[model samples]
Target: MGSRRRTPYGPGNPGASLTVHPLEGCRGIRAAGEVGLATHTIWEGVLEQAVREGEDVYYLELSEVTFVDVAGAGALAAAAGRLGAGRRLVVRRPPPALRRTLEAFWPGLPAIEVTM
Candidate 1:
């Protein structure tokens, strides 16, 4: 729940723009474009890096993320679970269309907010 920071919006390694930025004491991760079977490895890598770095809270600024498949969502959930109770994974400002998708598949997700 800090200020929103503008980041690069485009494709990343392997056609997925799964971007990340370490906000000093905070671990702010911004994942855009798509995340699915084609980019699950990238997604997992981002989460792993956050965990390994011992980030207290992994703020996944997912507003710009265009899509998230089952495997992608699972990867996120798995990472959050791995972090345990004290740790947090915050997702912010998702696209207008993904609401129904989030509700249908991952309804009780924690740390997810529709900021705009």
Candidate 2:
């Protein structure tokens, strides 16, 4: 798997970084680091790529991710919304707050499935 890294600085947070790695045996990505305003572009880009891949199920393995803001979670939900019927985004081991944010704002959304 190839690894790509991005570091975007935001106010009061200079150490912000996000790394995305292609999964070895699946059509998905595993991400690490923080997802905030500064790193959202990369986050959105990955999500868009997943959507364009047109797979029945796309995986986002985020167990190593440390933080995800509301907007980041919103971006994920939006990406899932773009999928065609019977397709879904499978989020694995995402941060608890990210899952809460998804449930709080986009309750019962069918296109996104979260697994701990």
Cα deviation of 74, candidate 1, in Å:
0.8
Cα lDDT of model 1 by residue, 1-116, tens digit = 12122333423334544454544555676666666555566778877776666656667777667877666666766676677556667667765445566667667766444445
Residue pairs of candidate 2 with colliding backbone atoms: none
What is candidate 2's local distance difference test score?
0.87
lDDT of 2 at 109: 93
Tell me the tens digit of each residue's lDDT in model 2 across 1-116. 34444454653257787889898898999998888867887888899999999999999999998899888898999999999999999999999989999989999999999999
TM-score for each predicted model, relative to the true structure: 0.65, 0.91
Candidate 1 CA-lDDT value: 0.61
